[model samples]
Target: MIAHSVEDPLYYLHNFRQVLQWVEQRYADLLDDQELAFLQAFVALEQSAQALMVRMVMRKGELFRSDRLDYAEIGDTVRALQPLQALGWVREPEQLSLDQLFALLRKDELAHGFAGQLSRPRAAKSDLFAQLQGLALAPRPLAQWFEQAPVGILQWCLQPLCDRMRLLFFGNLYQDWSDFVLADLGVLRFEQVPFSPGSRALQQRSEVDLAMALHHCTERLEQGEAPAAILDALAQWRSDNPWLARRHGRLLFALGRHCERLGDWDLALTVYGRSNHAQARIRQVRVLERCERWAQAHELAVQLAAAPANALEVQALQRMLPRLARKLGGPAQPRRRTTAPQLIELELPRELAELGVEEAVRQHLAQAGAEVHYVENTLLNSLFGLLCWDAIFAPVPGAFFHPFQAAPQDLHDADFQLRRAALFDACLGRLDDGTHRQAILDCFATKHGLQSPFVFWSMLDQALLEQALACLPPAHLKQCFLRLLQDIRNNRAGMPDLIQFWPEQGSYRMIEVKGPGDRLQDNQLRWLEFCAEHHLPVAVCHVRWGGPA
Candidate 1:
């Protein structure tokens, strides 16, 4: 019998898949389009919940990190609710205070007996979503049944977010909410299931499954298992499960890396060739280089450099060329990148130089309600970060745009692009208001704690975030958003030095600080051009160091 730990994260993933299948098979066909809308909303929330849990667990055991997931530290359902909130998936509660409750109560002798009195409840709580979650377990017509339960207000409020949800996830089962009862929302699937003997064996049989093998490999790697033993075991696992292995390209790539790390160049080279990952092929070249197969490595490197697939690939080839040339005796190709910005220089009062130009400008912006913050580095960067977050990442899934582990990597596929663009467009509607502003503040809670991998979310404080969200024009930020998110790894840098935000006017400007000789960087120019294209206000504050000239 294959032995497996009962606590593996795959166990949860397996169950999450079960919920999806249960909903599709049992509920999808039978339900009316309205009920199907509810069904789809339910799946969006839980599917994302499951994805978050699995990502957290797998991320803990990735090769880059040494620490393992503390399963005991796994949080409550509310934690799952938080991510859903990011995508307009939350049901806000309306807590009735004592006076409000008293107002709702029927007139009674006891209530009217006292001339000057007020009624108060011993305990008050907003439990609408919690109550609705409990009620959804039963098979009933959601609208009629909820109205009978007399919570129509909650259902009414649910409509906006539900609409937003359908918008965010590419138009769920139907275009409109019909009045129908759902056959099953799979609430039971949300509960934990104890691992049985059969299931336990299933989770442990890495020899039979590629995902299981991956989980095991990651765990062993994190545990600092002997590399040879790990490699040998994975080799056998792959040989035994060739069919499954063929479907797991990433696993093969990872295996190649492990072998390369162990100095098993032949195994690494062979596995890397078999791995269908573009990066793996690049790795194979490096493995050949390590094995002193200089001619083959050099030839491969030259061919790859001629047609580099991505920025990372281009960089890898460029770096390797010089080293390879040192051995093979040839001149390496030098890549030139020209990214000059539209330069406009300004002259500031020489007396201000004593106070420092950067400081003087920062103080000037602060006088106009642009609070200087220690965002990524400064107040302007921090504000821009939040402005970007409110405009893009908060509304979309974290997995959708992150570089290392982005979701739905069909970047070229029209359907995926259209869906992403739709969400971006819907988000732009909130440009001049406080819509989802709080969610923006809360969505990156993990990042603020420094426990998340998201690049831009965690850097701003509430003060800066509030100011940024209130001040930045949704139109200008929206215009600049996609490019920044697409190339977030590099394009995130070079925001202007100061922002003049006016909350009352819903207006802001990007001010790039330039001393006598400094000019705008490429990323900054990109931002400036986007602003100018949109007819948004931006300026260059060229502060030269000198006395009054």
Candidate 2:
């Protein structure tokens, strides 16, 4: 059953209440006094008052003009807001800056209110604001700014508190109240995994605060804050929580990139050195090379090459080591190269170009005895998702914290596979006993349409599933799945665009299509190399627009 329907006028209120109740029940100990009081006072509010507060919380920005808010379900907006205002949850803004005032006022209102200041009354709002910049207006209340203001601005003061509750419930700030509405409306769906009592995302109050701090730091970085300042702020934080630590690492990595763009090599080196992100070390090497520190670059590149983190790192080192060696006046290192995949050259009618290269290729390949489909990254990932549904959705502590998650929280963590090694082994064991086909089919039938981290329900139907099972060898599937588990964050993508099955012969070939002038991406190259090493039937299909010569 759905959580809440949009047909209900109080759907948003219901969703908000659900979050509050969830947080209150699961994270009571972690809640501050203010948060606990909010829960208590919110329940005591009248239905309209609660609804009004939720409407404001869901909307963008803190300030809302009273006249702009009109809800039919809540009889009077002002009346509904009174209880909230009395509780200090909503208040008239004590002051607003000129920019804030400009944001709140309409162009007509600005023109009408400051007639003498605006030399060109018909000028754009931005130009009007620019002309008034010389006045050097100080921030003041709406009343003090204008003699007769059309509407009073009300600010939602408790947004941060509400946001804390949301963070606790959703595990991240990216997914907001709209997620609940989307789930309710059936626009999005998630698997309902049972949660243990200790399955919450942030276990301690400190962790919650740290997550919020990292979020704010990210915002400041995006707003063009100096990298040095953000780095200083980050250096003060330390977290044992791996999830939060990963977030911290990502922020550092982003700051490092920003520094690189600004040509701040020293800062970028420091930032990259501090990050544990997968690509950070490679970036550090590149930065060293760029700054002409060939010895240091070569030393680090050699260390990384000795124990590369993943395929991407290996791919990068192949290019870096040779260049670094040349710069350091050392012997030229023999670069490792993979044999290119078998090639198919096509020249199709220009009229067929509109169908897209992959589609055109699929059409050309499809025949009386062959079946072709544009599967891309979906088919293999979906197969793996279906075959290992239990392992992926296991009820491990801190994994399935909420019912709305499509996959476990640590699906991309370094230890994701290790934590569920036994479970995955059991799941993959079906291959040996010749039960994997049935297991995959059963999952496809039973768990169809449920959200998953890997499965693409919209793409994988019964026909494709059967054909893949019939043609692709279990050994081949196992190899690909193992590679996926090696580094899911990077390896989940870059699969061939199309696959053709000769069901009669129990054989299939994966095809990576390249239109004229389009070349293989790095990830695609990695996948092609992997397939070649495994002796998997794969090819690169190159296409030109004109008719065959």
Best by TM-score: 2
Residue pairs clashing, model 1 = 141-181, 350-546, 350-547, 373-379, 399-407
lDDT at residue 11 of model 1 (Cα atoms): 45
lDDT of 2: 0.89
List the candidates' TM-scores in order: 0.38, 0.93
Runs off by more than 4 Å, candidate 1: 1-210, 222-254, 274-282, 290-295, 302-309, 322-327, 340-374, 377-480, 483-549
* lDDT per residue as tens, model 1, 391-471: 333223212311111223332222222435655555544555656465456644533532122334344456656777687
Worst 10 residues of 2 by lDDT: 182-191
lDDT tens digits by residue: candidate 2, 1-549: 346878788888887888788778889999999999999999999999999999999999999988888999888988898899899889999998899988888999989888977889899999999988888999988888889986788999988887888888877777788887764455566777776665566788898899999999998999999989999999999888877887888889999999999989999999999998889999999899889989999999999999998899999999989988999898988888679899999988888899999999999888545899999999999999999999999876567655677878788776788888999999888877889999999999988888899999999989889999999999999999989998899999999999999989999999999999999999999999999999999999999999554
Q: What residue pairs clash in candidate 2, if any at all?
A: none
lDDT of 1 at 290: 90
- The true-versus-predicted C-alpha distance at residue 116 of model 2, in Å, is 6.2
